[model samples]
Target: MNTDSKKINTSRISISELMLPSHSNFSGKIHGGYILSLMDKIAFACASKYSGRYCVTASVDTVDFLSPIEVGELVTLKACVNYVGRSSMVVGIRVISQNIQTGKIKHSNSSYFTMVAKDDDGNTVAVPRPILTTLDEVRRFYDSLRRIKAKKEHMEDTNSFDHTSREALDRLSDYGAILTL
Candidate 1:
């Protein structure tokens, strides 16, 4: 148990104050887009390091803004490589807004991003990703896995119809059907 605890602590990566612009917004609050941009950059870095290849955002499951981040606050973005697929990786990212003066911190946003590893040709490639080395890492890994699994299942439930008007037109063309009178 002691060994496992040590591993979990090492997996936690906290990045601080990459961006907290006081002049960026009129209300002195960091824009939602700004936070997202920072998260994307950090998440991309984490995924790219794990995959050892170029990675692109496949999807951002959810990015809920719980509170506003004021200017001059230290916005800390924490991320970890949670899971990996054949050519895909998922990263868990959290943004904590900390007031520099008062030292009050609040979770401003939390999100998971799916990234696809790509080769030099921009084609998807398989790469080694992070493994759950400790209990905390395992827990986060499972959570991300569950989220992806749920998303996949939910996607499957949607209509799989691939019918397109262009294909319909091609099919009708064989009948000499220019019946647009």
Candidate 2:
């Protein structure tokens, strides 16, 4: 475990790969699952580098696919440690795709991956805190804080929610889910 905190930029990583036809789906677009796999790999690399320990992805907070990537485009993924707790860190990732010929670039995806540091024994270990040096870094840190808070509240609400209740059942129609029960 790192005794001192690490700067957010210290562990930043960027990787770019050319999209190939084999990476595309039936729709002839780049596959979302393939991009997600790449994101997960980069997230793990960033978090592990920041914490100086092996890391495992605990959860993927959000993955928004904003634009479609062409098979011939170059896809780049950037990752950095956005926030850190005692044993976990949120790695923020941004993906962009660029056309080699036209030099056109499009934002393809944005996501957050929560990773937990682990010891050689496979036990959870302490991770170094993130040092925020810029306003953007501070904003990301606080945003992660809010996301964690909201997630906890949502889990609590879900646990106590009565889906079988008449009110809840009535709301099923709003989502277009048929209530056969």
Candidate 3:
């Protein structure tokens, strides 16, 4: 682990953009894909700023769109480094949309992005540790730890479980999936 550490607030970032018609879907609401792309950019920026190295997104977890954003609304995204390993960081992002006319703000989405730091040689590099100060920051760190553990356990279960077993095949009907085999 790298001994270098930085305060959590150092790398926190916030950005806002006015939603336009071009950014909307057929339903006249802002597109979820566009919001996801914005989230990715913010995650990359937050992780890179924290790590002081180029970072690549490894995965995105739990993108839940909570509200619809109107085309004329202003969308704001806030990103912060939630947790860090030797070479990886989890960035938590929250999206909110505000009706400029009514001054009403609604939470649009929340997501977690996992990013890996890389050196110029394309090798993984250790990132600076995060110095958490607030209770919310501590809670985010612990939540990230639990999420990581759950991911590992899920992968292990997937690797060891037998999908072709008779019991497993019989249970497919419970999910409304028909086995053509």
lDDT tens digits, residues 124-149, model 1? 99766344556877788788778878
Q: Report the alpha-carbon TM-score of model 2 versus the true structure.
A: 0.94
Better of 1 and 2 by lDDT: 2
TM-score of each: 0.76, 0.94, 0.95
The clash numbers for all candidates, in the given order, read 0, 0, 0
Runs with alpha carbons beyond 4 Å of true place in candidate 3: 1-3
Error of 2 at 4 (Å): 1.9
Compared with the true structure, all predictions reach lDDT values of 0.75, 0.93, 0.95
Ranked candidates, highest lDDT first:
3, 2, 1
What is model 2's C-alpha RMSD?
1.9
Lowest summed lDDT across 10 adjacent residues in model 3 is found at: 1-10
Task: Say which prediction, candidate 1 or candidate 3, comes out ahead on TM-score.
Answer: 3
